[model samples]
Target chain A: MTPPETETETASGEGGETRTLYGSPEELPEPAREALGDLLLVLADTKRVLGIHYADWILGSPTLEAGIACSAMAQDEWGHGRILYAMLDDFGMDPERLEHERGPSEYRSSELLDEPTDSWPELLALNLLLDTALSVQIEAMRESRLEPLHHKVSKILDEERYHFEHARGWTARMASTDRGREATGEPFREAWRACLRWFGSEEDELASGLAAEGIVDAAPGELRRRWVMRVAPSVAEVEPHLVQETEDGWGSAVDPDWEGWEPRTRRLRDAPGPDDEAILSRVRGDRNRSLLGE
Target chain B: MSDRLVQIERSRPRGEGTMDWSGVAAATRGDRPDLDVPQWDEPAADLAEEARRALYEVPDPEYPISLVDLGLIYDVTADDASGRVEVTMTFTATACPCIDFIRWDVRERIREIPGVSEVSVETVWDPPWTADRITDRGRRLLNRAGVSV
Candidate 1:
């Protein structure tokens, strides 16, 4: 079979299939429009950074098919990045400048994008959990009033569902083998910790505003609950040894300082660092260039 | 007294982000006192072609194909005097992560083939590779497997 149209061979696979532009946005809700800029940036950052992570596995994968699968997903993330950037530009922001020139701190992506995956299980968890989380938001975006963003999300969500299925299925298979079960269980715990840091607290204005205006349809915290319900069943089947968290896992999204919790914003603008360029350069330098081509 | 002027720093593998030959060489060959180290007996003319030939000799080791046909070989060049060969290649993508081991495996195999000199294996990104870049042999194999390139 020919490789999927979305896949290609490159160091990063960041240069995947070219994005087709949907029409520009018309009049939008003021709050939604304002939140759209950072929302798109966050999505774009997830694509770009995740693409880098996928590239890191080149040549190091256990098998050829594994490599091909990762490359395909990496390209998908790159394509997703482009789609978000296009939507941003359609909404009146310059995607080219925003993407290539922005700093890491300026990125609105969740913390899951910042951390690197050291093993296949970690990568798998990111796909199953993190991407699944993003997919939840995308489902809501399917009905988004913003035309360009809505159509793009609808297309992307379809593709992303497949990605989630692959990961979930793999997680199921991993449960069969003792080594797979153990190897994955520990990493899943660590990944869950990382996931906890993903969606921001309930009081974040941007998240609240986006949800209030029906831009994202739901806040990340609300989306996370759904995400858990969606993934936990499949994942727990494989690794019954896994520990489950209660609703207190993330606590209430509406609470500003929900007891023993700290508020983390999903907005790239709130990340603890310089802008995208600074982050990208740092990641680039640390990036084991040869690894990218693997 | 040393009569030969060697630019110690420059000649000492000063490049950043690339592997250090000092360590690799030591680990691979230094401890093995009995291992036969290949030597160059001829002048380094047509070094690129020689390196290309050497690289072509390396089978995928994992897959049932040669690196050239598998599309793992990208660019190959040689420095006649230094006997140094710089090869650029790529795997399927960042996700096909086993490439590091493949690259190192290829490098080791190539280096052991009575190589005239050094080997620099790098991963280049410009002019991205596609299935179309695969050789006729690769295409035939793909066809046999019902895979369209």
Candidate 2:
């Protein structure tokens, strides 16, 4: 749905100025509200799945420190997911229902996290490439006209710095070895393609409408460019198209297959997310159902 | 006991010019009026030092080093009047699963101090923690534990 050009006035704030443009979810046009809600769900689901994947390796990591790092990253991802899910309450979503009751097919998470990672290299690819892509999208909302996202976006990004560092450190360590480098190449390329597709095509009506509503600071193309620029340096060894050195500097211009893409979910094809039993068991915590107070 | 008495005395509101020592004397259940109340103007430096020493005993769950030695305790302060202690701290990583354990340990250890009536730990992320933040002693401990800083 295209966002109506007209704006609606809502309640005034401390300054007593009437906000007529994307002030709150209720104030937004129907299209803008739906788009924002979809975006938040996508982000929350991606983080939730990523956290689950990270938790799978906590005990299986090659070293004690690496395992601890996985635990840390998992906690960070879960915390971020919780925050994002809670924010959906403002968008008229029942946060609890959204988190605990969602089935595999209902999740709007990126396809990159559709399955549990089987190898450390695959994990690193998700960590370094896909995680950064999510961060890049969140970073675009740092100055979002939607005031509620300001502090949440900033805090989430702040925590994400360590995630980036952790991923970069591990990626560099793995890439240093001949076998390790070879192992990571395909996973990295696969993750790169998913991230590109996750950003959607520039012509996506939802993306354009959201941008027009000022809910997000950048368009899809700009968001993708920033993501590629940030990720290019770390994965430069994996693929040439991942990063291209220009006279101006290194940049990425890889064109992913946007055909058969689901613009709303931002996924390349129709596929259920992670296994419902696995995700729900961890997320829902049935054993704690009788316990009172969070 | 003397230190406790001193804390109570120092905690009295200033600018009253004079304190009613008779009330304190009665409260102590002592008939003697000759109790020499120690100087009540001591800086909070002693309390801060004591809190720091207490925190040094609280070790990181995963590492051999204490939280204080690990440079996790950025700052510790106490409000003498309220007997409230506040500590600003950070974890080795933002996603540290031991955050609850570490925070609980810090609070428990500091609350054991005589003058501390309340303890609050504020976890911060600004100027995000790095290996460089680890102290020399912490590095030595990690090295001894077969871990690299």
Candidate 3:
């Protein structure tokens, strides 16, 4: 179904006449608002889960510097997640409830991040593949007509540069070693499939509707293609299905299993998310509950 | 640094009332005047230099050295036409708790400059910060404070 065109009002600024679709959540059409809310939840939950994954590796990483990097990445992901979660308030959801009280089944994170990574190489695969996929989606919203998103996109992307660098550096280093490549190859393939599936099919109504309304800049297929193009250089051997050399440029050949796809959470199955008890204990800071009000 | 240093131009017209800034496209190093090493003799240069110098007055909350010495201030430019001083800075860490206060301090301190009609402070994370960015002076200061670099 074709989404209704966003109602834009013209305003004069230093850059010239700018068109704004919605200044606040109340001004959005119900469908557009709902679509944006779901997208935001997906981003928030994914970041939250990625943060936990990174935190788990803080002590387990092979080197002290690597451990510190894990700690920093964990902090960055949590910060990004908190910022996105706070934006849900504009969409009429209680930020605290969505963050602290949500059960594992209610999480809207990607399936790749739903389970603890088994090895450092697997963590690197998640970092290089899944994290970059999420960033690509956020990048598509850089020029969103929605004001709130437009404001926050730059900061989120700015911080994410380090994440991309850390992942790329490690992936290249690991790819040079036989043992490293062997350990990471399967995880990379798994992450690649999950990321492709996370983008959903071209027929995703919410994604199409959001793209039509200028709330998001690209459709799921376009986003998946961009992500593959970005990641193919480092991981093409491990996941050859990502791209093919076309006359124009590199093109993606994604055949996601759309059957049983959960649209709201953007996963392939109704699996429970990361351990709820551990997530709550870390996210809620239960020990600091006494100091919360102070 | 390569020949492709991103020159971010932020301007706020006088009497706009709002403190909002609009950034121009990143220009090549050759296209823009070099603010990396302020002349300190020119009027605009003096203001920009004074702004950079004043940053030393704003210390990192945790460290004793100035934010300038700490390598927190990345770029500082003065727009003569708009009387706006724009500063691009970054935190030592992504999860810095002092970010808001440091930004506020930077804004307030730079506004103290005479003829400065507006001040804009932007925080960026590109080329993410590390201990190597710290200056020798900052290192000494940190060592003096019983903190190793």
Candidate 4:
């Protein structure tokens, strides 16, 4: 859906003459700068973890072609992670520390990617739902006031097009069979909850501030709605508990369980974030650390 | 920079009713003011030409075709005085497994050009690549290699 346009006055000079964009990260004002940092961390960290999971399936997917797609998608995620991390460098964050030194506790990734997919159908649900969740959030930045994102965001979105298609195709294929639908049910529910919940609530200041400052075109709730519209139809048949169709078309089947949700980490207060240091170890290239050279 | 916050332009106004894909399939998406603007800070045309010519000789790691023919070299800037060369390029795919290899190749090849002291290879994704970006030379070469255009 086309989002409501922010007025030029709030988004630009006092006269509201024209919308002027931040020429670079250097020009960002105080809180918007910090908010963009938080936003990028969430995106880059999620991509990093998602890439690791995709890498896990490269050799074991149901088909050789699926395996190849996994390899490509894994590379795409890592490549995107690298780009986002580089962008964070503008905020005085060190890429090396973020990628290598940080543990699972620091991750802003949705809990859905916190664990490995036990089955191919589960992975497809993640690809269809979680990936779209990330893509729509990125889409919110398509006209970011942060000028640097014009290129960076568009580039990342280009690579993700194939990811969405891959997910949509596989989910449709898997949804075709009763057995497949049964298998995908649990995973779809997991992703459905994660995508909606992780987007944070309308009350979340950081998500809304990013919009108020024009760093993102939409706030958290709108992005979640867009994500639901994108994935609801794909998961509807298999996951009755997670998708609803109304006269307005697609909407979440249930209210996201926002209890215990922490807006800062974008995780629940009670649940432990992914305790998998092993995945972090691989992403940091721990085994091959000896081989890394200047 | 002013501390005052400015609201951003919503990419699409409500009632436009189109999916906000940002014209993902379109050639270019939005403005980029910070990154290198080829036209604004161009190096000597002759030097840039030399850099372009050199890049044309560098083949993609997996393909025999030159980077120029593949439409991967977006812009080449050469400073005859400063001996600096910047090649702004993109890959056939973002996850081109050979991205690093290609970057190294572009850097090393451009470095070989006379008068170049520093080489920077930057990648951009706006105006995403399609078969349409392929040069006539790229088409002929790919056709010769038994790959359909």
Candidate 5:
């Protein structure tokens, strides 16, 4: 196949070698373009839901500062989602329709966020396990060969540093005591399994195809390793059996069960559960339809 | 700060109406310039400076210090030919509640300049805003405002 004549940006990669980057979505190979669009939709949808999940805990948090942090993180998620959704028009998708028209069966966020976190421990689990997974995945695209997105990815990663500190700080605090640890243990395990599976498995066509195209810097297994290494130090103490410290770095003791895993949506089901619809409705601004200028 | 210290690009013509976020790819650093637009020699750079000088008049809602001095304005460049000034900026935190007001304030302030009929404010998060981005003038202003930098 002949390369289409398109302006390709080049990134100064490690070791001083320059790698070609796709300047626009139209320039990408068919499979890679589809994979990237799918991946981005999943991420944007999850950020919107995750923002609400964070917002749910803002008022009742254990500390004022923690509640404030939740408020801030929630805003960041919505802002991030808007930026991503705005760019979907280039992928032949309508940004407004994607954000407003989707139903529960159409959302691409994880099942973990299918409902509001029931307790502080559950929210913390989503923070350390689920949020960190999203960050690590974004980190892999910091030098994405998809040129337009690489800088945007870096911007999102910079904003996420505080989120990690928030998660790590709260995780250590909760895991520090027997009572705190016991309350957080089950939630962490459930969250870990879901997030670990979110990266998909070795044979995932979408994950592997994107890797070959250099859209995401690392492959699925590598991304999972980064996710585990990121979450282990704070989360491992409480869920000792769930995480394993390797000779070199970190590992997960329980491998992901792929029975219900859906690659495109990165969830157990094809879309969010019915319980997730209420908040998803709010994300669509169903209540304030009259106020929206658009 | 490398050899490519100059990330400035000549702005292209646009409709003068509507005040929303605009594309920064042409004005952003390291992007290949749009071949169709004629490069502005020097007056373009000067117009951007004029826009920046104007921002000193707009104080942050919470603080008295100018937004320029506070380091919120990332990059300011103007196209004298098109009368458009593109300002790339960031907030101190994602949760800054004053962002909407700040953005409106920015557009209004830039429009006050004589050669600036169109204003574009693009917000970025990468290399997130830090105290180090604040200018020495900002420090003195902050000090005067009873806030230690």
Candidate 6:
């Protein structure tokens, strides 16, 4: 008799096709888990660093209203980072150490999140494009078989709605004004390409492996396509002078500042340390059964 | 030469009175107290003008927003003979993180003036700075940078 096909591949309605093969965290396949872990690290670290960057502007914003909005946004991103890190923590790693100890090079976040917001318009576009894309990604993860991740993803999706709305409102206002349109259009056009680079390669092995294991619901390309479609119409409405396409949106390059930047942090006095080994041991032991699905 | 020395002695300051010690103090100390006090012997000169002229020589490297413009050097009084200058300035913000560094930089540079013997920098936060207080030149720079002043 012919051997049963070990891998399953299928197309989800979101985009081209979601080919599910095998990278589920429950099964504890070494290579698959490693790739998924790296993907999670990138996502988690990006939010963490972006949170810090936004927090720096809390009192420095040009106006009081904007300052409060930015502060709220910073807290939201930090909260998301915490949740994602907790997932990584359950997977045999210390989230606190991973956050403060890693250099920029070790982070997997896209070049988009690294650039300091040089102007208000650039900041608005980035918050719109990047966070909106993240919202969709989190939505997809709602169905993940990794119960903890699925729960965390669902919670994050609810929190990101406000971020998405804020971006849309800011972009709408900027696009409506003559000077705003004149000033922001070119930068928006330029920044979108950097956003595109954030998504991994079309045939990224790590993404595909995660899909195979039913850990991640879709590939980055599918996510990219959905993001483009969702954002292009609104952006076109705002900047009628500009054309919208995958190339215009996704082929742009990253800013040099963000191009090679990474988080540079050290352990804070109150941060978790090696002394928590006993507590970690207990948690790890209790969760090991569900974690490894042994 | 002896005659000239006698004339110089005649021009010296005359003491008002020597410090008096009471009989009780002499009995407690077992000796009388003797005091010597120095006095300004020469006529006071117009040192203020000389100090003002000296201040002109101190380069205000930051232009359009000089020490005067930013109000950093509130008072530039000096004792030219002693060459001591006291400056009163306020920080941009009360919680300014750069306060220590700004004070050090100003003190170091101001001390380089030829006649300056001592420099004191005092930081005050009262009469806080506002955007309207920015000089015309500072306003122009902000406008050029696309910021509304």
Best prediction by lDDT: 5
Give the range of the ten consecutive residues with the poorest summed lDDT in model 5 chain A.
A269-278
Residue pairs with backbone atoms closer than 3 Å in model 6 (clashes): A21-A212, A22-A212, A22-A213, A23-A212, A23-A213, A24-A213, A104-A262, A193-A252, B83-B117
* Leading candidate by TM-score: 5
lDDT of 2 by residue, A138-220 (tens): 98887565655553566578778878998888888877888988888889888888887788788888887878867787889
TM-score of each: 0.52, 0.64, 0.68, 0.83, 0.85, 0.49
Candidate 6 local lDDT, residue A231:
67
- By summed lDDT, which 10 consecutive residues of candidate 2 chain A come out lowest? A1-10
What lDDT tens digits, residue by residue, belong to model 1 across residues B37-108? Answer: 234577545878677766544555344345777787877777777778777775554334344455665567
Docking class of 1: incorrect
Better of 1 and 4 by DockQ: 4
lDDT of each residue in B1-149, candidate 3, tens digit only? 22122212111111133322212111211123322222345553566777888777776766667788789898888876666888887776556755656776777778877878989776554455668889897888778778898
| Model 5 accuracy (lDDT, Cα) | 0.76
Query: For candidate 1, what is the DockQ?
Result: 0.02
Residues A48-140, candidate 4: write the lDDT tens digits. Answer: 888988888999998899999999899999888877887777788977678777777788877777776678987887788888888898988
State each model's CA lDDT, in order.
Answer: 0.59, 0.72, 0.73, 0.73, 0.76, 0.53
Please tell me the interface RMSD, in Å, for model 1.
17.1
lDDT of 1 by residue, A115-175 (tens): 5567888777777877876777668776554444564554466456667877877788777
Give the range where candidate 6 chain A is weakest over 10 consecutive residues by summed lDDT.
A262-271
Clashing pairs in 2: none
A30-136, model 5: which lDDT tens digit per residue?
78899889888889888988999899888999999999999989998987787677667778998878887878888888898887788999999988888889988
> Model 2: number of clashes?
0
Candidate 4: clashing pairs of residues = A10-B7, A11-B6, A11-B7, B27-B127, B83-B117
DockQ of each: 0.02, 0.06, 0.08, 0.18, 0.22, 0.00
lDDT, candidate 6, B102-127, per-residue tens: 44445555566667777765543223
What is the Cα-based lDDT of residue A5 in candidate 5?
64
The CAPRI class of candidate 2 is: incorrect
In model 3, the Cα lDDT at residue B145 comes to 73
How well does candidate 2 match the true structure in TM-score terms? Answer: 0.64
